[model samples]
Target: LNHPKLSLCPSLIMTIAFAVRWRDPELVGPARKTPRETKRLSDIEDQAGLRWHVPFVLFYRGRGGDAGADAGDPAAAVRRALGEALVPYYPLAGRLREVEGRKLVVDCTGEGVFVEADADVRLAEVEAAGLTPPFPCMDQLLFDVEGSGGVLNCPLLLVQVTRLRCGGFVFALRLNHTMCDAVGIVQFMSAVGELARGLPAPTVAPAWSRETLDARSPPRPSFPHHEYDPVPPTPFPPPGDMVMRTFTFSPADVAAIKKGLPVQRGGKKATTFEALAALIWRARTAALEIPAGEDARLVVAAGVRGVRDLGLPAGYYGNACACTCRRCPPPGPCGASR
Candidate 1:
């Protein structure tokens, strides 16, 4: 973002020299495509897409540095860990790319502003199953997180780990601004903890360069900021709509809600979020439970991103977000694993 040394690019501006050759297809005619080239487009177009700007994704992996986990020529551990970890990641190499390679994510995309985080956060996952390995990244994961959720452009990985003398690990992760917003970062770390323990990774492979307004090729023209804002104020289509609201709670109120048996009538270990959401759902259902003819629904927004690096595209300036429905049949009672 603000880094000077290793930051790749501050914005997506195509040099005049390069933009010159991009011809108006209607005026000059479509550029001739060889049979092989046409097939390549056909083959990958279904799966692969254009990302607008460059991005950087960093994943931190650490082993004890001493004669123990961090010790004893531990580079082997690094190699082994990366190998096994990325086993399901082969299709991702080219899948994640940049307009120009860089060490930091936002340097190239010219996509987002920087936000600072000083506190550590945590997230929990439930168990689920649908697809196994030997696959490309999922288009959507729990809460609709994507393997391609990094920015549409800047896709690189930054990883740092320190082996604690106490045999613990300290990791630092950095990424481009394109794929995820601030909250998505925390979800990613929690997902990583799960992955290290051999759990299923989140889904939500990002979609890129779908709109001309986002601009896949550059000389990146200046445009209205709201056009690229990921969450535009407009309402979602007929089937899905979103409302933003905030709740206030005092310490004692939260404590009472957690401890009161009435809150846990069914013997459930209700999480703060889950309990709160359930309360809202029940109250709302009771108030508006009677529909003239159909079932009611509750939806929750789920932030998404790749725990590992993804090659995205340039010209990407977006909010990088998706949602998952709570009512969707769960793999089990605990819900979905992200």
Candidate 2:
């Protein structure tokens, strides 16, 4: 481990200590009949395609209460936990391959990439330096991704564990978006963490029942779902440079905002997310000076998990979110005009 102390300046160097293939153990065998094979992507998943991988990094200070556990080789412990976790999430271990030029499917190859790295800076130093508007860089924190064909040819999953100078660590993960959503990411990561802590299995076991999300026979729609309406092909404009800024809202700030929203006659209130989203939407539209005569819409996605009528099991990990479009005139106070 390189222990040269450094600050979190632009010149800080992060080195890859080692890179290795972390495939499933021979004892776990192959991903043959596990519900992970050739599993069809739901409409939501299909729409996402394989254009990007969801990458996330978690920073932990010190040994994180584990004490003497995995004292000498924490990365090895994480790799072992990941290997065991992959047995249940075998699809993540697989590769995505195009089926017939028109569709894509998981190849179920049972392979992944694991990397260990060393950062010369302490976690506190990095935090004090302040991350930028577009999120912090994962350059040394994650394995460098290579471009392959139109869709990335990288492994379905890539993980990097970087040790900090202050005995802290960062666990970074890159997951293909086609196979998992935000919910699935949480589910998979939780499983790995549990196993790393010497637990037998994840608190919530993953289920690969993609068939439940299939389109109905004859595809009858009980109600109009304008959210999925097809738009006429139009000339595409060049993409604009986008900036993402993370905002932290304190409990008091959230409470104040919630208090400003009107309560329904029945005393019902909008959720914190709904209230904040409305405020943001209005602010953006007003700032952009959108025409009042134009129609504006808020596209919201709601998860259908635990809905009694869906008949989905508790462990189902496939796409379960449905989108709804609420349209309004592009003017007035926050477009809440009924």
Candidate 3:
């Protein structure tokens, strides 16, 4: 085990020493024969910004003496479950292709990557400080295998299972963002878990009717989308020494902030999200100390699952969200107001 210390913050440094024994990645496909077909992605899914892979990691402690624990190989069991899960969600076990107009399509190949590895570190030791973001030794934990990170002609789903010294394990995956969003991936993982638990099929069946989200033949102009309008170039260059920090707000703190806000029309109170967004925007604007007359914009992405007009089905997994930009007047009035 190689000892390497990673500094998460000024006061926190963690030693992540783990010698990983990586096995050859194998292709896990659908358990049953699925039709080989080509399906075009929705316009939103084929966007330039969404053509990358999203990585996620989940850590599990040892199930010490649990009755439900698998006596067989856990990695093998998970691979088998993934193959079963792909039978219904076969599009994920495919490769992406781009045709004319940069439109992306899925060529159903029934190939998904599954890698197994063993780490010399203990899960308890890794969680000694705190199970938080900016994890130490992230590259080792979620190694991007060769030929698995491309946006086209690559496996849409890549999973790695790393067994730790204490019988615990780390599950990491890279999924193409254009295929599904966070909620969609969670649904797929839930289906895999259900198959692993010996279920006949997923409670919610998989759906891939992306054509429902296609744009109208003749684009109908609805509300003006000002977010897409061109903006003047910024006078200042981008900051190079940027640092990421996570802030935690308790329920009481959020409630207190909401309590200070003025009641809306019809006696409706401000929501927790609204209050926190306002508070954070004000604090950030003040900290940045931008010019008083300059406008500030806060962008938020909202899901369209609740919108009745879209007519999305229960198991439809795709990009179903849009970003809304709110333009603030100026630093002075924005920060000074309630």
Q: Of the candidates shown, which would achieve the greatest lDDT relative to the real structure?
A: 3
Tens digit of per-residue lDDT, candidate 3, span 194-232: 898899999989788798788888888697665655654
Write one digit per residue (lDDT tens) for candidate 2, span 1-338.
Answer: 12222224243223223222222222222223455456555655666433577778888887543323445566777888988888888877777766663455676767677766666666776666554334445555665544311243447777878776667778988777777767878888898899999898888988877777777876888988867766334333345743456788888988999899888659988888888888888776665566666655677878888688878787776668888777676676544433
Candidate 2, residue 242: Cα displacement in angstroms equals 6.5
lDDT of 1 at 308: 29
Model 1, 182-237: lDDT tens digits are 54344444444455555554343223332322224544545333222243132233
Scored against the true structure, residue 287 in model 1 reaches a CA lDDT of 53
TM-scores for all candidates? Answer: 0.28, 0.80, 0.88
Ranking by lDDT: 3, 2, 1
Q: Return the top candidate by TM-score.
A: 3
Worst ten-residue run, lDDT, model 1? 18-27
Local error of candidate 2 at residue 60 (angstroms): 0.7
**Which residue pairs come into collision in candidate 2?**
none
Task: Tell me model 1's lDDT, rounded to 2 decimals.
Answer: 0.31
What ranges in model 1 sit over 4 Å off?
1-75, 95-154, 174-255, 258-271, 274-338
Looking at model 1, residue 170 earns an lDDT score of 30
- Candidate 3 yields a Cα-based lDDT of 0.80
